[model samples]
Each structure stands twice: as structure tokens, then as C-alpha cells.
Target: MTDNLPLAGRGCVVTGGSRGIGAAIVRLALAQGADVVFGYHSDEKRASTLVDELRAAHPDRQCSALQADVADGGEAERFATEALDRLGRLDVLVNNAGITRDALFARMRPEQWHEVIGTNLDSMYTVTRPLLMPLVKQRGGAVINITSSTGLHGVPGQTAYAAAKAGVIGFTKSLAKEIGARGVTVNAVAPGLIETDMTAAIPEDKAEFLKSLIPSHAFGSPDDVAHLVCYLASEKARYITGQVIEISGGLVL
Candidate 1:
């Protein structure tokens, strides 16, 4: 490993890492000298392909993928156990597994609310609970949760998603204080209208309207978010904790 690399020798775990922002984090983490074990929900083919590509690219570092349903406590625990075993240690945990079940509040179904809450908010506990003790015991690590701007400013059709992500912000602050003395840093990264599968699903007219809200009038890419996440995971951000750093191009400003 290059000694000058920012995350050299760190063992990291990322959830929902097969695609989008999570995949970008995994790729950049490996490039920056971290051994990463990431979790994927359902696309085994995509996950395997990512693993193969990364392994080929970073022949010196460890890059592995495991099937995980972060919304389920049992599955999350199992994934955590296997991740720790594979890496033989843990230093960074990125909670990036989430889903969007957007609907107008009046028309939102019960299952939609539950599904959004379960996958986004509940997974925060299910995934972090098992992996947290290791970081605490080690006395140094980072926990970066991927939240959304909707969680901060709220959105009309994303009441459930916003609620869950807002809960994530609350969870992040509380946990940062709880573990700050233990040398663990916890923070949330809120992205605004990033170009991802989620944003692609937005109607073109709506997307244009949202784009106009940003000062840059352009959507951020997954790599933009990944850069911030990797920085937080590195030693440079060790002194930073319990903050929500928004990566939007001045959206809602």
C-alpha cells in the first residue's frame, strides 16, 4: 500500500454499493487504498461484475461484495459478521442503502410508508448496530450516513422518504455524541438532486424544474457525493463529526 494514500490500510464497509453513489464510493475507496467489503441487495450479476472490475483494477487491495437486505435485522447482522471476518477489521461504515416510495401524502399507501421507512430508517439501526461496537472498541472510525436534501427542507411527494432521512439525521447526531469520546465520527451527507437512478425516474418536466432551482442549474453526479464521503472516511475528516454537509449545487438557497 502507498503510505501517502489517505485511507491506506483502512477496512471499510458500504451498504447499497452495487450501483449509483454507493458504487462510486466503493470504487474511489479502493483507488485511495482502502480494503472494502460492500453490500448489495438483489443484483448478483451487477455486484459480481463490480467486484470483478474493482479486483482487476486494484490488484493489491481487497474488494468483495456480499448479498445483504439491510432492512432486515437478521440479514444485516449476518452481513456485518461476514464483512468483519472478510476484512479482519473495520474502520469505516457508510449507510447508503435506501429506497424511495414517493407519493402525495394523501394518496400514499400504508405499504409505501412502511417500505420507505423500513428500508431507509430502520436499516440505520439494523446495519449500524452490529458494526458499531467494533469501531467503538477500536477507538477510531467513521460512520457516514447518506441522507437527502428532502430530509432537511422536505419535499411534497417524498413525505415518507424525507421523514426517514430526517430520522437518519437525528440518529447521526445522537450517535456522534454517544460515541465521540470513543474516537468515532458520525455524520450525514445530504445530496440534492443528484443524477442517479432515483433522479432519472423523475418526469423530465419536473427534473427541469428541479434543475432550475439549483444555482448551477445542473444535477450533481454520483462521483461528486463519493468524493465527499471518501474525504469524511479519511483521516483528514477525523476532527469533523455530527454535521450534515450538503453537496447540492446551492439548491433551495
Candidate 2:
């Protein structure tokens, strides 16, 4: 059974793993046989509940959650340190934490812009910097960053989000090149209109409009994105790096 597992014996760290796609990734990674230490921003209850559920379901695996603001370097560093301590060694790092401040560029406040940028873009640096050396030293690992289609195609009311996610793409490519020779695979996963808490807040009319843009005529489930992410983290995708894989159910917008 262990040999059949894609991530058997692997150690993983995920950011923003309390709910939504990040949570999905944490769940699936553990189900696939990895020991995981995930970070949550706030909502200790939600995070603890998730950790409890995962532990119950996978009694043989290690699962824990810690609180950290990925936007702050100090907090992120502490989270990374604690996560590494819990996992012992890291084989995969998932940068799944992000926030969206949707507003037109002209009307966007400074705080909104900065918040989105700090969480979505700066987190790539804050979280990865502390854990990257372990991967390089091992000369084998995977880094999967969660970006969004808004970054690739651009959205009308998401200027700050688009900028931050786009910056994530640039960061993924450069880092992949820098560490590829060391056998670390770095890639970005771009999700489009996944069914999560964030999308649940969309207006009925707006939701329908967004759905019409997708060739599937439906929003993808969090599991859809999780499957892609897990595949990237597995040895199956060892040769694939420095790429942005979009799982948007063929959403044009």
C-alpha cells in the first residue's frame, strides 16, 4: 500500500491550508501518503478541525497546522521553521496562500493593493526562502505555487490580484531556472473559478456570467485543482518544471 502511494514517506508544507483549495491540497497530499505541516493565517478553530479530521482519517500519517501571516517575513519564517521541525525534512512545498482584493485600478485603495500583493506575491519569497535550501541540499523536491487565471488572462475588477499572481508566474520561472540543476522542480498551478469560499461570495448573476465563459459551463471543484497539484508534486512530474499549468475547465476569461 505504501509503495502504491504517490507521495509515500514524503514530507510536505502548505500555506493557507485551513480551507478552500489550500485545504483540499493538504487533504489530498495526506491521503496520497505524505506527512504534512500546513499553515493557517487565522481561524484556529477551522485549522484545528481540519487537522483533527485528517489525523483521524490517516492515523499512520503525520498532520499538523500552524498559524502564520505569510505576508510578514518574520511570521512566515517562523512558520517555515516550525513546519520543517514538525515534518523533519521537506520533499514538497506548496505556496497555496493568497487573497483577492477585487476593485478597479482607479478605485483601489493603497491598503487593498498592498494586501493582495503582500499575500499573493511576497509570500512566495517569505515562505520559500527558508525551506528552499533543504530541497537544494537534498537535490530532489518539488515547489508548486498556486496562481490564478486572472493573472494569465487578466480580469476587469482584479487589478491588484492580477499583478500579484502574475508576479508569482515570474517568480516561479526564475526560481525554477535557478534551482533546476540542483534537481528541484518549481512550477505554478493556475486555477480558474474553482468552487471555494471565495467564489461562493460571487453574486448569482455574476456567477452565471462567469460560468458561461467556461467551456464546461461549470465551476471546477477544489479536488480538480488538487489532483493537478498532487501530480506535480509526485515523481511523475519530475521532468516538468518552470511551467504554469492552468486548471480552469477551459475558461477563456
Candidate 3:
């Protein structure tokens, strides 16, 4: 965070930012001059390495990584508390952390359902409840929740995952209404089908077919969503809120 950069003094938190899209967001934010804190469940070696790398680039911008299972209510609360503490005040909260336990409804175990819901849906409450106020106190702030296209339109064998993501969409819209007057904006990004470790396990032929369905004929990058996030967090997006923006290469249309 050199003297001339914008977003230099802003404080931000990115959950599950150790790898994939979350990590990409971390890098983008750091480069844009925002001091950041990222939350992780484990793999301190990887997490610490990322923090070190970002801090190296911006000595004045602080970066912290905390180990917390976003699925656990207590851990989520603690993560939010310590994140705000590290940054002093939070201007942005990106709920980019999620896990998928894909299974057909007929054979989906009860545990699969719970894990997906707890990690994906219930987590919204756990993480945001603790930090919502600090952002409002800042006079204005942004809350970005990461969702999926499968959630918007059901997919086979992903009942649990789809349900959880759909829950995020609904929750964010309602919260937007509740907080509109408080200077806090709530929005959700429903990514259609981007390449990530979660989807790396997907069969190649299937991936190709999915890509063909998309008009762009290509997968989106993490930087794609990160750009939207950066804009929404900035003064440029002051008038946009309660919207569920999709980044699916025209897959829905």
C-alpha cells in the first residue's frame, strides 16, 4: 500500500482465501492497495505462505490468516471478531468460502446434507452476524456472497450443494432490504461454471459438455468475479445492492 494507491486504507476480509477463487481474490485485493485478512480451516503452511507473499508486496498493508472452520458457528464468530480486530474496521466482507458434498437425493447421506448446509448456508449467519455492524459503522460497506449456477437451476447429484447456494441467494436479498437504510449493501454473485479445485474432480467429458452449453465457449477466471467484487466495494457501486449478479458466460440466457 504505497501512498498513491486507492483502496490502500480500506480493511477487508476474505474467507476461505487459501486457494482457488478465494486466493485469487486475496491477490487482487492486495494489489489494489487494500489491507486484508483471510480465514482458513487448516493448511497453515499454505495460508501463511500466501500472507507472506502479499505482505512482501505491500509492507504498509497488513495481512493476517486465521484458522477457523466456517461451518462451525463458534469458529465463524471468532473469525469475524478477530478479522475486524486485525483490520481495526472492516469495509468489505467476501463470503467466498464453501464446500460441496454432491449426492443424488435418493442416496445422499444425512451427514452429506448437514455438512453442505452447515458449511455453505448456515455459515452466512455465523460469519456475517458478528461483523455486520462494524461495516455499517464505517458509513458504507459491501457484503459479497459467492453462489453457483447449479443453485439457481438444479443439477443432478448436487441437491445439497444447490440447496445451500440457493439459500445464500434468498438470504442475501432479504438482508439487503433490512440493511439498505444502514449504509450496508448485500449482494450475491452466482457464478455459472468456473474452473476450480471443487470442479476439477468433475469428469472431463462432462466439463466439455457444460462448456459447450455456455455461449462464451470458455470458462471464467477467478479474476472475473474479483473484478466485480472490487468495483462493488468501491464508491462506483454505491447505487447497486440486493442484486444477484451472474457471471456464467451467458449460460443462463
Candidate 4:
């Protein structure tokens, strides 16, 4: 309601916002008073449900979702264009869409490698390239890429995932330098062992093993990552860019 709120009146677009960390970012963005358009790859039911809930809570805010697979360049472009159409302009772009294909390097199939790379790394170019000019023209905004702890420290069976996430980090740093002069802050958030469906799939024994690796001896929640993203998207973080801030509960330290 008040302009003093960090992201009041701003517009945001979040990819893969139908569930998990993506969903948390969407909710936090709306709570910060930003009009948001989010994309979902397949789960139309979940996407529709989230949109409905947000709309009900903020009747006057623009909260919408589109079914899109941002791994495809054409779909990414269309999703960005539609987001601009719905919100009029963009102030924050959260590249939170990614996938994991965990397998030992020796056992990994080409499709597994391709899927992870296309979704996690290539989607960065596809989703952000179309919107880059407009964001630069706007002269102030934030671009937050969701990376991972595996990217920071290599994981044994996650060769493809780690590589893709590492690429995201590299892309974020390079883009930040290019866009910083234009007032668009680009950064990456790498989460560790977050309690999402992705982590839920880990066998209980493996999950406990990971928990032991974290200094906090626990898995982080989606909100934990969302809170950091909210700060990075705000004016408070204007001076912060080209950095990878990890929310790993001391896992990487």
C-alpha cells in the first residue's frame, strides 16, 4: 500500500513458479507489492491454484501464470512478451526454472545431459535475452538467477546438474557486469538441501547424510531462499551484483 515498501508498484516475472522455491519467490514478491507474472512448465493445476490464491488475497494486484517451458527459446520469448503485456513493464526477473538429471558421469545418457543443460543453462539466454533490452531501458531492476550448492562444490552423481548450475553462476556474473551501468543488478542465489519435492525424493538415509553435511544439521525451507531473493530484488540491494549468495546453512563454508 505504501510506496516505502521495497518493491511497491514494481513488476516481476518468475519462471518455474508453480512449485517449490519458485512458488515461494512468487508469494514473497506479491507480498512486497510487486505485480507478478509467473510461468509453469507442466503443472497447470498447481499454477492455476497459486494464481487463484494470490488473486483472492490481493484483488487489485496483477497476479497471473502462463504455461511455458522456458528451456525452449521460442517459449521463453513468448513468456517474457506476455509478462510485459500483463504487467506493462518489468522491474524484476527471477530465473528460477531449472531441472536436475542426477547420474554418474559414466552412466549419464546424452538426453540426461541435454535436458539439464537446456533447462538450467540455455534457458538463461532464452528467457533473459528477449527481456534484456527492456530491462536496460527501464534503467533499474533486478535479475536473480537460482543456482545451487552442487554448482559451488561438485556433487558425485550430479555431474550434469552441477555443470548446468555452474554455468548459471558464470552467466550471472558476466551479465551483471554488462548491465550494472544501466542500473540492472544481476545476481545468483545458490540454495543447499532445501526441503522441496526434489529433495523429498532422496532416500531417507541419503537425506540424513546430507543433513549431516550441513552445519545446521537440517534442510532449509523454500521461504529461507525466498527471503534472500526478496532482499536482492529490492532497492536495498542496488549496490550488490555479480555475486553468488548461497543459502546453504553453512554447507559450503
What residue runs in model 4 are displaced by over 4 Å at the alpha carbon?
none
Residues 32-88 of candidate 2 have per-residue lDDT tens digits of: 999999999879999999999999999999999999999999999999999999999
- Sort all candidates by lDDT, best to worst: 2, 1, 4, 3
lDDT of candidate 3 vs native?
0.87
Worst 10 residues of 3 by lDDT: 1-10
Error of 3 at 206 (Å): 1.0
TM-score ranking, best first? 2, 1, 4, 3
Q: Count clashing residue pairs in model 4.
A: 0
lDDT-better candidate, 1 vs 3: 1
Q: Candidate 3 has what TM-score?
A: 0.96
TM-score of every candidate relative to the true structure: 0.99, 0.99, 0.96, 0.98
Considering lDDT, which of the candidate structures 3 and 4 is the better prediction for this target?
A: 4
**Local accuracy of candidate 4 as per-residue lDDT tens digits, 82-163:** 8989999899999999888788899999999999999999999999998999899989999999999999998999999999
Residue pairs in clash, model 2: none
With a 3 Å backbone cut-off (N, CA, C), the pairs that clash in candidate 4 are none
What TM-score number comes out for model 4?
0.98
Local distance difference test, each candidate: 0.95, 0.96, 0.87, 0.93
In terms of lDDT, model 1 sits at 0.95
**Residue 203 miss distance in model 4 (angstroms):** 0.7
Query: What's every prediction's RMSD, in angstroms?
Result: 0.8, 0.6, 1.5, 1.0
Task: Encode model 1's per-residue lDDT on 1-253: one tens digit a residue.
Answer: 3778998999999999999999999999999999999999989999999999999998999999999899889999999999999999999999999899899999999999999998999999999999999999999999999999999999998999999999999999999999999999999999998888989999999999999999889999999999999999999999999999999999992
